[model samples]
Target: MNTVKELFRGNIRQYGMVIALLFIMVFFQILTDGILLKPLNITNLILQNSYILVLAIGMLLVIITGHIDLSVGSVAAFVGAISAILMVDMQMHFVPAMLISLLIGALVGAWQGFWVAYVRIPSFIVTLAGMLLFRGLTMIVLDGKSIAPFPKTFQKISSGFLPDAFGGKIHMLTIIIGIVLSLILVFSEWRKRSTQQKYGFEVGSGALFALKLAAMVAVLNIFTYVLATYEGIPNILILLFVLIVIYTFVMNRTIVGRHIYALGGNEKAAKLSGVKTQRITFWVFVNMGVLSALSGLIFAARLNSATPKAGVNFELDAIAACFIGGASASGGIGTVIGAIVGGLVMGVMNNGMSLVGLGIDWQQGIKGLVLLLAVGFDIYNKNKGVS
Candidate 1:
C-alpha cells in the first residue's frame, strides 16, 4: 500500500491518464447503452484507429526529438494514391506495389530530413511544405478522383481475422492465445523486476507490482474475450501489437532512444557530448516516413480506395494522441504505451460522440476542446515542476 501510494505520488499524471481512460470507457459504455463495447463495435474501433496509433508511434519519436512532422498526413495520402496507381492502374502485384509505396515514403522522409537535419530548416516548415506538396501529388496521381475496389488480397490486410482453429463458436484460439500472452507478460515483468533488483536499480514494491500485473492480465483477457465473441482478432490488431512491442523496446532499451531523449532535452548539450545529432534527427524523420507509409497502406486497404483527402488532419490526430498520452510539449518525455492509450482516448471520443448521435460539427468542437485541455494540463504540470 505504501509503495503504490509512493508510485502514484511520484507519477500521478501517467497513471491518472490511464485511470481517466478507464473512466471514459465506462462513461461511453453506459451512454451508448452498452453499444460501445459491443463485439462488433470493439472490432470496428480497432480498425478505425489502427492507422492513427501507427502514426502516433512515429510521432512520439519526432516529438521526443523536439520536432514535429506536419506532413505525415499528406505523405500518407500521397503514398496511398501511389499504391492505388501501382496496383490498380499498372496491375502490379500487391506485394511489389507495397514495397514501391514504402520506398517512396522513405524517399519523401529523406527529402524532409535533409532539410531539417542537414540544411537546418525547421521541421515545421519542411513538413508543412510536404503537406502541400504531397496533397497536390495525391490529387494528381488519382486525377482528383477516388480510386476503388482494390484486389481482395490487399483488402484482406485490414478486414480479415485469424482463422479459429479451435472449431468452436467461442473462439478457443483467442482465449488460449490470450492466456498465454498474459502469462508471458506477467513472467517477463517478474523477471525484469528481479534483474533490476540484482543490479540495485529502483524497483517498486511487491504489492504494487502484483496489483499492476493483475490489472494488466485481466484487461488482456477481457479485451481478448470481447474480440473472441465477435470474430477473433483483426489482422491490423496483430500488426498493431507487434508494432507496440517493437517500439516500446526501441524507446526504452536502445542507445538511439537515449540519444533522442538527450537531443530533445537539450540539443546543444547533446551535441557537445558527442552525440550524432544530425544523423539521429535524419533517421528519426526517415522512420516517421516508413511508419506514415505503412499507415497509408493500411488506411487505403481499409477504404478499398485512395483519394486526395485520404490523410486529411491525420498529423493533428497523431500529435494530439501523444500530448493526451502525457508526452511533454517541449519533448524529452513520453512512453509508447502512453501514446497508444492516448489514441484510444481519441478513438473512444469519436466513437462515443457518433454513437450518441452528435453532429459532425459538435464532434469536431469537442475534439478540439479535448486537445486544448490535454495540452493545457501538461503545461500546468510543467510549470508546477511535477514529474
Candidate 2:
C-alpha cells in the first residue's frame, strides 16, 4: 500500500496537466458540438501555441535557477522591429537580417546578464528595467509604425507547412514516426529505471510505469493524427521539436542544467559547490533573450508584419503558463513538458471560449480563475505532500 501510494505521488505531477487537458478537451468538444477536436482546429491550436511553448521552455530554465525574466516580450518586440528594418528599410537578405536580429538579441541579453550576474543586481530588477528599455527601443526603431510585407522565405518561418511533396499524404508515416519516438522514449525510461534498480533505488510500480507510457503514446498518436489530417505538420512544429529535443538534453544531461536546478534548490549551497551561480544566471537570461527574439521573429512572420503592439502582454501569458504547468512559485521545481502543458491549457481555454462565443471580458475572467485554481492546487499539493 505504501509503495502504491508513493508511486501515485511520484506520478501525480506528471499526469495533472494531462488530466486537465482531457477535461478541457471534452468540455470544449461538447460545447462546440465536436468542433474543438476537428483535425484542422487541432492543428491550428498547436501552431497558435507554439511561440508560448518556446518562451516557456526558456522561462522554465530561468525560473529553475531562482530567477525570472520579464524582458522576453519586449526583447521579441525589439527583435521583430530590427528584423523588419533590416529586410524592409535596408533591403537586406533574409538570412543576414535574421542573423543580425538574433545578434542584437544576444547583445541585449549580455547587457542584462552582466548587470544581474556580475554587478550583483537582482534579476527581477534588471529584467524589469530591460522590459521598459526594450519596449521603448522597439518603438523608436520602428518609428511607431507597422512594417509589412516581409519576403516569402522570411515569412515562412511561422506560417509554412511541411512540403507534402517530400512525404505525400502519409498519415501512416506520421504515426510510424510517433511510434518510433515513443519506443525510444520508453526504452530510455526503462534503462534509467534499471540503472536505479541496480543501485537499490526504488523504482515506480509497474502499474504506474505502464500508465505513464500509455498516456504518452495516446497523446502522441492523437497529436500526430491531427497534424497529419490537416496540413501534414507545420514547419514551426518541426522547429519546436528540434528545440524540445535540444533543451531537454541540455536540462537533463548537461552540467549547466544541473547547476540551474541546484541554484534553484539552494543558492548558497550551489555557490559554495563551485557552480558559478552568477554565470548560470547570466546565461539563462541570455538564452531567454535569444528565444524571445526568435519568438518575436516568428510572431512577425506569422502576421507578415511587425507592429508597435506586437508583443503586448505576452510575458504574462508565458509566466502564467509556467506557473499553471506546475512550476513552483518558490522556484527550483518544474519541467519543460510542464510549461508546454500549461501553455496548452491556456491556449485551449482561449480557443474553446472563442468557439463558444464567450465575450472578451468573460474569457479573461475565466482564464484568471483557472490560473488561480492551478497555482492554488499546486501549492495545496506541495503542502499536503501529495506530489
Candidate 1 CA-lDDT value: 0.93
Query: What is candidate 1's CA lDDT for residue 9?
Result: 64
- Give the top-scoring candidate (TM-score): 1
Q: Write one digit per residue (lDDT tens) for candidate 1, span 162-278.
A: 889778788888888999999999999999999999999988978778988999999999999999998998999999999999998888899988999999999999999999999
Q: How would you encode candidate 2's per-residue C-alpha lDDT over 281-335 as one tens digit per residue?
A: 8888888888888889889888889888888878878888888898888778888
> What's model 2's TM-score?
0.94
lDDT of model 1 at residue 347? 96
Q: Which candidate number maximizes lDDT?
A: 1
Please list the C-alpha lDDT of all candidates, in the order they appear: 0.93, 0.86
Kindly report which residue stretches of model 2 are placed more than 4 angstroms away from their true locations once superposed. 1-5, 165-173, 205-208
